[model samples]
Target chain A: MSAVERIPILKIGDVLLASIQVDLQDRDVLALQEDLAEKITATGAHGVVLDISAVDIVDSFIGRMFATIAATSRLFDAHTVVVGMRPAVAITLVELGLTLGEVRTALDLEKGLAILAELGERAPR
Target chain B: MTAAREDIPIAADEDVVRVRQIVRSFAQRAKLSLVDQTKLVTATSELARNTLTYGGGGAAVVELLGEGRRQGVRASFQDSGPGIPDTALALTDGWTSGRGMGLGLSGARRLVDEFDLDTEVGRGTTVTVVKWSR
Candidate 1:
């Protein structure tokens, strides 16, 4: 049996990068999501960049997890941005009525980095 | 082996690909439209995964329906695991029992034209969804 992998966290300058490499299946996604959120809060970074490019689909569980991360980041005074959402996954998210207004989204990692920089500039130290 | 006309029972461990193949085969035999075929297949895949996760494993029934002049496809997922205690709460968005995001049932309902769910505590649960081609 293959072992379940946890998400990886990287601290680069003021940006805390959280990368997810799992299949995001029905099982084991919630625990991974909660762990990522807690890690973001504990890091106390200026902003968070979540890279989900490897994930082909963003089901309701993952989507809700993104929302939770965004909400929790606000409490920690850090902004969260989601990066690398595939077109099909985006359409599915829209059809499912997931509100991603509060959480910023970028087309790629570079765009996400730009957003994180902008968010840091706006936030007071 | 000749494909049977009766319902096909699938194990819970099957992935989305197998579920899609089963749905497509049934829809093709029924001569359903490509659009309806895709929708039904996607919805069935979602529900099948839910059954395995929350119900601890279950079987899906794929049937070709013909009611006089109208022809359609109907698929039902039945599980012997713990039945949903609160149907309304289960249907609500973001209310997931296991690791799901709680959109399987609601999303399945939206994909099909006709959806029916019946469940009883300690008994089990059955979800039947139908899509017609005019």
Candidate 2:
């Protein structure tokens, strides 16, 4: 039986960080999308930060998957932020008309964390 | 040998890189703006990958239309795999027969100026896309 590869999980203060590895092969994309959503739900953190710095391209499918994860994370009462999108990938996403307006994005992990902190403070009691 | 241009078959996933290279070459030859080039290339990649995955391999034929006037590029992707049953549902954003979000065909259509699809059950499917110079 083939062993399942575990996605890397990192704890950054109160935030649960999950980094997506760079391969981005066609077959792995769907699974990666589902896994990211599950991780966010299970962690029950204040916010979920996804680092896709390793990914060089954001194909249509993957781009949609990111939107799905963001929507799903919100259902679990967690905010989702995607960081480290490559310039080419960003351009491709825009060209493909995938306006990830719902998914908060930042230039780097630090910016993502800062946004998360701001969102955290603004949450309703 | 000088052969008719229409007689040539589109090239499929000979290699993953082939799709991108062809896109870049065609974009330059067509004199498409950078934004339009990226849009067309991304759409081309999605369609090419579909040909490889569901079609069990196929070819994409690209041609630059209108020499001096009305210039544009037309790309046709033909595959010998089972054709889609419901064209309308297939065009829906979230519909997919496989793991994909079903965005390939729909998104490809959205990226270009003109899109056409023809298919027959058990026969095959052919998608043609055109991007005009703006």
TM-score of chain B of each: 0.86, 0.85
lDDT of each: 0.73, 0.73
- Give lDDT tens digits, candidate 1, residues A1-125: 23445667788887788777755443455566576567766767878888988765565556767887788777878888999987656765666656774899999989999998887888668
Candidate 2 docking category?
incorrect
The two-chain DockQ for each candidate, comma-separated, is: 0.17, 0.22
| lDDT, candidate 2, B1-134, per-residue tens | 32112222333333334665566567667788766776777787777777777776667787777656656778788888898889999887767787555778888888889999988888888888888888
C-alpha RMSD for every candidate? 5.2, 5.5
lDDT digits (tens) for residues B8-105 of candidate 1 = 45453435435667777787777776556656766787787777777777777777788888778788888887798999988776677666566788
Which segments of candidate 2 are over 4 A away from where they belong?
Answer: A1-23, A31-46, A50-57, A71-78, A84-102, A107-110, A122-125, B1-18, B63-66, B69-72, B92-95
* lDDT value for model 1: 0.73
lDDT tens digits, residue span A11-75, model 2: 77768787877444444555666776666666667787889998655667667767877787788
The weakest ten consecutive residues by lDDT in model 1 chain B span: B8-17
Score residue A102 of candidate 1 by CA lDDT: 84
